[model samples]
Target: MSDAAVTADLETYLSERVRSTPPSGIRRFFEIAATMDDVISLGIGEPDFVTPQPAVQAGIDALNDGQTSYTANAGRADLRTAISEELSSRYGVSYDAEDEILSTVGVSEAMQLTMLSVLDPGDEILIPEPCFVSYAPTARFAEANVVHVPTSVENNFQVTAETLESYITPNTKALFLGYPNNPTGAVLRRDTLEDIAALVQEHDLLVISDEIYDRLVYGEAHERGHVCVPSIDGLRERTILLGGFSKGYAMTGWRIGYACAPAPILRGLYKVHQYMIMSAPTVSQIAAHTAITECQDEVETMRQAYDERRRVLVDGLNEAGLPTFEPEGAFYCFPDIRSTGLTSEEFVQQLLEEEHVACVPGDAFGPSGAGYVRCSYATGLDDVKEAVRRIQRFAAKHQNG
Candidate 1:
């Protein structure tokens, strides 16, 4: 009953993976910021906008009508049909509503389900570095070997097929993509995606494409639009597309998202989802259907606001002496902080303490993120402008350090 013995026994009870994996690098800074005054946080990724009124009303009405019970394991048929139609209209991809789509708690669960359904122990999943923090860990939780393929700001943090091919091994079974990517805010171009699709075909690998930010591409990026992975030739059968209402629709709390794939692959995800999550919240599904059917104007309004903030933040960071690549999508800008002679961890910690501006250390995403920091532009414009001012002051002090 000694303290050391008790500790040892506790350690023995948890799996090594759970014990060894570190906590999210994104959360600690936020927790610290919460305890401070006058802090401007460009840290978290949730949208600042309220959920569109129609969707909110839908949820309220559904709840008032006592529609709180679970839907079918694959989610409400109407939601699934709407999702199928939305994808078809937006991307020219068709999914059978009855069998090729499943609504889950969020893209997070869809990701977990995809990993569990398609990956086996010792299988390797190639994930580009500077990715969303959850990508590698979720695969690890599913007992897959995560190969972090490094991308750089030199190429706007994009992963090319040639680069991905170099990382492939016999054990490599899938590619996990999070385009309009987190931390870096990078989107894969059509040619690049085509190349990746070809590579996937050559390798005969499954793909888990997390496009939760699919609707958030901006300006010229929007002109090109998001290249829905399954919409690409030869990829539909092999790709699992994950999307949700959280980012673009401002429904993060609703916990509704979906996975689409060929029916057989989707059925696999459906099985895992049914057992792991009985169904997405029924009211959320109802609300999300309203989001899809009634909220296009609101979604566009939010996109325009984010686009405006994106320009200001990126330009400000560059002018502040932190070289930032213009993000084409999503709500983050990753700035190179190497000019300050500090590691990403050092820069963010010092910036937090000295300036009361909180953002995530880039290396939290992967090793390739070491010289950078992630600043989310999902907050108010004035807050972003003020954060830039604080960052400028901090950068000036340490520019030659």
Candidate 2:
């Protein structure tokens, strides 16, 4: 407990990377909100629904049958097979389960493994701005640089092939594609995917497609679901598709996810998975298997509820005089708060303190998010309405003054 001993321990114990990495912004908001009573949180990006009953039953059955031993590091063969079939059936992308897939603790681990597999120190990863909070930090942890490509409101926050091409450098090793994106619900069309695929091919860059929200589209039935980079010509062999049971199947706490990539990349990912995680949770894998095969109806039911909430939240925000872009997919609304003459962080803080409504500051996502705020509609209809009422009252007082 002496000063010198403490100093020596601090110096010796912490890795430089761990010392430098900032706490997650989303987590910080959650902590602050936890101290306040009567606060309605529309901030966290998680499904409010419980895991479907069938998936729960599957896990119970697995445990009752005494099937808790470690499965293969790449995951249970049956789960991987189901993932492969699900990909082909859902996205029109073919992946061989035996050689090209690896189950992960979650899409979070899959993302980190993918980056560590391909990125080296000083190599750059092209990420579209207003992305998930983890992308830049994870890239940094992999000793890679991040080059953010800014997407505009005019473009619905979708990254175009031209925008992507502008960021390519000799050191650029991969592109992080988050469609039905976090914080913003922008989605890519098939033609846009093809264009980006061609550009990535020409640049010889790998694509890491984060399609965790693929099944959460909120628009018309005729509209396309989330598009994967691998589905585009010339991109299949070079793209790593990341999926999970969290968002789509309301299985967030189960921590089940998978990655589909080319054989060689998957081999490297498996090695990483083996050492870092050993294997994903056994019971979660069982639940995930059931989710992939028999939970389509549950997915649709949740999607319909999210769709309705999305409309209610967006319409309410606009009515409150906040300029919000209509989200085509996903369960978030990114609204411009610059007109209120406050920074994104200030707006969010004041909203939490004065209105007792919690939302994430857009700037937490990236520079492109500086003037906006991300409101997630993943909660109940009643909470969404109350949050909007609070926001409207806040906006009126702020604007009038």
Candidate 3:
């Protein structure tokens, strides 16, 4: 057969879900930015900081000590215990280290495990929109129906219990939450979380709460601190909490994260994890264990820097006529570009082409993001300042005709 026939045959064998889902909308912009010179990127969610010294040293020590092998499927027992203690101390929530926690490659794998473990084909998961790009697709990959429940800047990009209840159907099995949200940088408040917990109880729904950016919260949001979902009343038994060292401890390359739930639920995730991943990287697990135990000062230092960058970017975008809401968590600013008479994609494309500043279009996250663009403050302070200048120049050129 000819190459075209072979290609068509392979395509025919592909799963319908795999073929239908497009590549991440965020990747296209990153690809274009890669070919350009002197581009300032505020597109990716990754931190610019290096992994903390203690964690780095820990990984090196493990290697030097010749400790390189697959860990127990749930990851190193000590790491799990450290995580349990960390959560208990930080959020007033406790877990059985041996049974309630399962470490995976990263939060990405943890998310996939949760979706597969909890969702049956045709089951519906209600996800708030303008969320992380992966949440909906991961559920779809699990053969679950993804129901988007849109939230707007008017509501501060937070999904309410009332809004969620309206979307519920008989087949709805879970609610997927990514707060200290990607793209929008929105964090759910304690009161809102309480309301959501009550709703979840009434509906008898499970919740997958992705709190990867939990430690990166800022200002008033930080004052209240990050609320671990299971810590909320009525939620402990029903919520699967996904967290990682990527954002909080600058360990993206280490690829270490975990999922914690009630043991019965976690066992289902563990079964999937053991078959799919077996275990997280042993060295990375060691690094993360050190990070959890010996890196609080380092985490705080990086967070302070991100908060500073966040302030500069938010202020700069608003001054640039972009009308950005002040994000209280994570390191992103979603700025409205409608005033410049540009669609989110058009603004992002033109800005990249003309100003050499890279940002993801808001709609790439969800339709609710159509009039805005997500600019990450995870880049350097200098780059953020320069990107702000370029954006201002671009905005002035296109402002309301």
lDDT computed for candidate 2: 0.90
Arrange candidates by TM-score, descending. 3, 1, 2
Better of 1 and 2 by TM-score: 1
TM-score to native of every candidate shown = 0.98, 0.96, 0.99
Best by TM-score: 3
Candidate 1 vs. true structure, TM-score: 0.98
Model 2, span 253-273: residue lDDT tens: 999899999999899999988
TM for candidate 3 is 0.99
Cα lDDT of all candidates, in order? 0.93, 0.90, 0.93
- True-structure lDDT of candidate 3: 0.93
Superposed Cα deviation of residue 156, candidate 1 (Å): 1.7
Residues 23-70, candidate 3: write the lDDT tens digits.
Answer: 999999999999999999999889999999999999999999999988
Clashing pairs in 3: none
In model 1, the runs with Cα more than 4 Å from the true position are 2-8
lDDT of 1 by residue, 1-401 (tens): 99999998888889988987899999999999999999999999999999999999999999999998879999999999999999999999999999899999998899989988998999999999899988988899989999999999887899999899999999999998889899898998988889999999999999889999999998788998898988888899888899999999999999999999988888888888878999999999999999999999999999999999999999999998999988888899999999999999999899999999999999999999999999999999999999999999999999967
lDDT of 1 at 115: 88
